[model samples]
Target: MNRHISPDGYRVDGPAGQDDETGADLPAIVGRNLRRLRTRQGHSLDRLAKLSGVSRAMLGQIETGKSAPTISLLWKVATALGVPFASLLTVEKQAGTVVLRRDRSKVLASSEGRFTSRALFPFDSERQVEFYELRVAPFHREDAHAHAPGTRENLIVAKGAIEILVGQHAPVELTEGDAILFEADVPHGYRNSSHGEAVLYLVMTYVETVG
Candidate 1:
C-alpha cells in the first residue's frame, strides 16, 4: 500500500481497497472513536487541540476521517482523552475464543516506514496492559514521547541488537534474548544500529485500566 503523508508530516497508510479485520475502514474507525470520545468528554476541537498539543485543524481532519494519524499523534490524543492508546483503533469485539491472525493484525508505522508496531492482542476491551510487536529498521532510531504517569514498558529483544535510551539514563544495549523494563513516563527511544532489523516484544502496563 502507498503511504500518504498527512499535513502534520506523518506518513499514513493508504487504503488497500479492502476493509480491515473489522470490516471497516481504518481511518473511519479512528475518526468515529476519536469523535465519540471527544464529545463524550465534552471537548471541542479547540479544546482537544490545546490538551493534545495538536493543531485544531489537524484534529478536525482526523475526526472527520480526512486524514489518518501517526502513532505519536494518536498517543497524544489518547492521553488527552484519558484513554488507552488502542482505544482509538478499537473495533467490535468478537464473542468467545478469538484468534488474531497475523495476516489481519493491525499495524501502525512511523514516517518513512522505518519503525512499525503491530498489536498482538485484541483491542476489543479497555485493559491496564497491552501487548505489541515492534520492529526497527537497521540503523534507524525511533523516539517516543513520555506516556501517562505510572506507565511502564517491559520489552524483550527477539532478534538483532539495539539500544534503549530512557530520559537521562545511560543507553541500555540488548541483543537477542535480552530484556529490560523501564518507566515510560519519560521520553524514550529505540536505536537499531546493527546491520539487521531489530525485533522486540513489548508489554505496556498502565497504573489502572483505561478506556
Candidate 2:
C-alpha cells in the first residue's frame, strides 16, 4: 500500500490487505491510528473515552487489536474520534480498481424497523462530513440525539413527509423535496407522520480546529 498524506497532513493509507490481518493484528493497527489521531488532536485517552461513552480499557483493546470490535463498538469509537466507522479499517487492494455495486453497499438498519441509514462515504477523515440516505417507516419516531460541537446537519426529504424538532422550536413539517439545515448540538428528533414511508438524505459535517 502506498501511504500518502491528505492536504491536511493526516495519513491516508489505502491498499490491498490493509483490512485483512491474522489474529489481533487488525485491532493493533486500528488502535495505533486512533491513538495517533487522538494525540494529534490533543485529546487524552481519558477525555476521548469519556466523550465517546466507551471504557478506556475497551478503547485500549481496540487500539491494540486485542479485541475485534462489533458494529456498535466501532460506532462508539468512530463517534468519539469524530470520524466515520469504516475509517478504522484498511481497504482491500484491487487491480484495475473494480467498483463495488450499489447492492454491495453496507447497510445499517435501525434496531426497531422504524428506519434505516446507509452510509455514503468512508468515515476516516479527521474532519470529514458524512452523507447518508435515511429511510423512515410510517409513523416512526427517533429518540432525541445530539452531535458534537460544531457538527451540523442538512436533511432533505425525498419522499413522503417528516416532522423534525430541534431544540425548543416547534416540530417542523417537511414534504418531499423540502430541505432544512441546522446545527446538531441541541436535542433533536425525527418522525415520519405520513401514511407511507419517508425517504430522506442527510448530510453530517464535522468541524475541527487545528493549531
Candidate with the greatest TM-score versus the true structure = 1
lDDT of 1 by residue, 37-153 (tens): 899899999999999999999888888888878778998998887777888888787678878778666677774678988888877766788999999999999999988788899
TM-score of each: 0.90, 0.67
As a whole number from 0 to 100, the lDDT of residue 48 in candidate 2 is 84
Backbone collision tally, model 2: 6
The global Cα lDDT (0 to 1) of model 1 is: 0.84
Best by lDDT: 1
RMSD, every candidate, angstroms: 2.1, 8.6
Where does candidate 2 clash, by residue pair?
A: 16-93, 27-65, 28-64, 28-65, 31-63, 84-123
